[model samples]
Target: MNTTHTSRHRGNDTGTGATTDRTNPPMTRRLSRLVPALCGLLLVLVGVTACGRTESSGATTTDATTTGSELSYEAVGACKDVFSRTDAPGAQIIVLWDSTASVADMPFPAALAEDLKTASLDDGTLSVIAVDGEAVAPRILAKDVALSTTGERDRPSVAKLAEVIPACVQSVYLNGLVPTAPGTDLHRAMTVAAEIAEPGATVWTVSDMMSTSGQLALSKAVLAEPADQAAETAAADAPVDLHRNVWKVSGMANAATPLLSASREWVRDFTRGLCRGWNASGCKSIELDPVNPVRTATGLPKDPVPPFPAVDAVTTATTCSFTLPDELLFDGGSAELRGDVDEVLNQPLALLDANAETTLRIVGHAASSGAYTAAELLALSKARVQAVRDRIVAAGIEKARVSSRGVGDTEPLAEDIDPSTGLQIPEIAAAERRVELIIEGAPCSR
Candidate 1:
């Protein structure tokens, strides 16, 4: 949910700062009345069936359209939403519980709950772990995740996954008990969570980020602590081994540090450094709040800009948008296009061939995050489109037949989140940061 490192997605190199990925996605998806052939109808239906969402006949609507290798159906999830994507690997999630605290005392943040629901919609499974030091194995909270690979978000089948994920975490917090533990051993518990978290897995930790025992503890000297020395001497039992994966985790990141009472400022500073030390692949934050939660609700920093709640101007066969992640086409913080753009333009090539004379207007988009300001983002989007426009023109298309512009974050680039959970579908938000080609005219040559 953290947008800080959302750029690291889309297979971009880690060394170049967080980039982008097209693998998992989401947006404000809605069923587009999919009406595939009878055979395909049954095949796609499963992907769109609603859980508690209903219709006029009081029966869930059974409508969708399937194309290419695309199958659209709704699955009634605990809480879900519509989405779209190509066939891809499912996601794996590890939910780590800070068993040292009671659910009543250390309540889970509502924002983080939305993050869980957003993630569940992706194709994957959720495993729950209790950090009680009692060595409890991970348990599956949700499995066989349904994805809106087609990029639709409005389908009724979409449950408020945003709610479901956080709820699942709450279940563990409320029901889980620590029979034997010296104190809140956050370091050890986090180590366990880090050990199991794969690079691609999303980790949500519920705790105050405080370590009562084991390795890490409150210390004034901790400020001057070097990564290596801290690891060898004091942090021996701490989670040094899991920094790479931990670098990409989300959820509230603050913990109660009574030691920093002397310097309230150091609490925030030290925690921020610790999160940075993890080199989190997603957003990075070490809050000093009693509950410093760390989840980027559906890949965005909770922004002040109102979400583009309305579904976009519908795409007709002749004029439609093709999404290309800005990071995939260009490097981070810059508009320079990469050399392998031809590969990314496979669909464009086909469209060009059929609509040789039609004009193509590429619109560049950026997500709302700490990455850049609104104006800077708009310029970035515009520049990307201009770069791609140049490419298409060079490829024999008339220079006048193509144009580009940057709409910045003004359009439906990010997904509309459920107000309660503050989570949108992933693909929906990812869809916002892209170069979309708006082609001109009627159905192209077959």
Candidate 2:
């Protein structure tokens, strides 16, 4: 969990610590760097599986699920979400902005901002990540991170932050931040998203599905029959985590066309495999009107931009304690276990078993307000921590030995309340909800 940004106008910030190519030539490369920030459903209340979401075209679009180890369309970020008036509670959204040559023209961020502005955000978060062409093959900049969980009282400010979606995307070009590198590190950008993005957040990627990253060029030899480059590349870059209901925008890959279809499958399989490896949930590709790809800085699209991506984590491992985001272990709202939760818990469980002398404390928390009543919220919090304790107990750890408590909205990772109002800062309150395991062992010395 993270705090809200200082300024809501994240689109204007030049960002900190910028590094371009050694040679800054006139009319340099196409684009420079890429940013893919994360946001997700803080709670899995509505369940992503429910279908019939409204699109920008004023038409209903449904997601089609896929089985097997391959990737398939699951959720599409439609125009309706972008144009909607209010956002729901726990509406976490992450954008994989593609400044790649073919995806620069579409205008969808404005719609996303509409969705975010109207969001009844009690503890939800929004992050808009941008990735552009850079000097290095895998040039990625951790800039323009707009994590809005601090609880903003001014709803318009929250929406205004999202309204600059185009500006956030264009800032790279306007500020001359993107590099003129030869290849677009689409693979690396999405790959990084898997590792760092908020787990299970809606991922809206705007790209041409062209993985031109020098690391995995789609040449004849690379895409040969006996060997598949997509899988090979996925294995190389797939993180231990992955994307949420992905909504890909403006990609030219087609299922009907032979060559295009093959390319589409490669990208889809690669993306899905990558997410599956990270143990991420459902995904989908969204289609929008054909917008000309923008190359010049002046040509960047503009819209209501939500908060940008959050800055990287600055952890102080000075103590022997670990705090895991609820998104990592269970769905956003429910205590239902994700397939990898046990796999993730095994390490901690083993540690606990190895050091029986050490005491373990499980604290469950919930972000207040939104659709949930206060009592139900606390119950859910309790259920989450209990679930964790249950897992430990199932693994043979003594139930009595492990102390579990559900502390609802009391302990917050980021400061979400304002002293004057004595109320929650709507922008960042969502960060408060989490489960933390505190380990205390004075006897054992590291």
Candidate 3:
């Protein structure tokens, strides 16, 4: 796709190199011829030099050995160079900053600063676009900033960009850090990246990559779909064709509250698919920088709750059962309900309210493993379901409408014991331990 730049702030640094179009061929030829005489005069004056004028050729060949003695190697410079390739004229680096509420609590990535410090943008532009909402535009952070000043005439034999580029990045990044916005439209952010990106530009999407709102909103229901299907469905909202650009997603699976393993995996897969939808030259994700001690995720929503884990549902014309795995509601060996159980019970409670004739039956199961004696296991199971029944009754449901019971290690989905060693399989045991909420006389709507 053709790259369209909307930013009037983008500065084209002509000093870096020549343009592709040959506007004045005759003048160029005359200058080309005069170059030999000038080189010869310079050689005579210096008394020792190559005729090709290698030192003044403008291109400084990178040498690992010379980095320490001739030039100080730094991490920031390396990160900058990853985006600002000296040979790619008109290249720009777009930082798709995600200031959505989901990541508001997270501190800015510390490694980003170190990585940027070692970069030498030379003549590249660094731009920042807030992934604030679906419509935010790109802004110039360091327009046409020269990142390195090494070599003769350039004289960088001792120079480093350990300060300049990082300072620019920090200045722009900090200035833009205002109160957090609500949504994370990653597809929209990527489209903006493409719109503002120059050919060969590298786009860095720095956020949790959770599209929580808008057309590309990655709700738990959407994330529940098969990875490829979910990705394709989201991509269909706004597809970007990045002909030669690169897209890297960082700060994924990171939040004030740790995300579920399934959540992380689904987001990774969805983003991978989204990147493919954009047709980027290269795609990188979940590549977060080291935590910045000063910028921890303190802005998280108060008592933040992750989306409820998926539970198995059984439905009929008049009865519905939800199987919530034990880990979701209790600590191992404990019957007390988890702090989040109230939220988890919202659905069942609502269903009961809607159908006044419905009666709730809570049944708890225990793993058959040797974690407890059969009597203890049975007691624990009974207490667990009783806790759930208490919660439902507390939520304004009639106490008489709810009945609870425990079935200890009687119905296992998998073999709890290994025939060879007779040891319980941890996974099977865990899976076997679950509580089922059965609602009778009403059809569940999901």
Per-prediction TM-score, please? 0.38, 0.35, 0.48
lDDT (C-alpha, whole model) for all candidates: 0.46, 0.45, 0.58
List where candidate 2 sits over 4 angstroms from the true fold: 1-92, 102-104, 109-177, 225-229, 236-240, 243-270, 284-446
**Residue 182 displacement (Å), model 3:** 2.9
lDDT of 2 by residue, 1-446 (tens): 22223322222344342332222332112101000010111012113333222111223323323232111211112111222212223445555656543333444455554444433233244454555443344343432233232233343323323332333333322234343454455555665555445444565555555545544344333342112333545556534445444444444332111232223444555555444454555533333334344433343332111121111222233224556656456654688765557645765666577777666788888776656787887888899998999888898888767899997776666776577876766435544656676655522233
Error of 2 at 75 (Å): 32
Question: Which candidate should be chosen as best, given lDDT against the real structure?
Answer: 3
Lowest-lDDT window of 10 residues in candidate 1? 301-310
TM-score of 2: 0.35
lDDT of 1 by residue, 301-375 (tens): 111211111112335777755666653566545788776567566566567767766677777877654446788
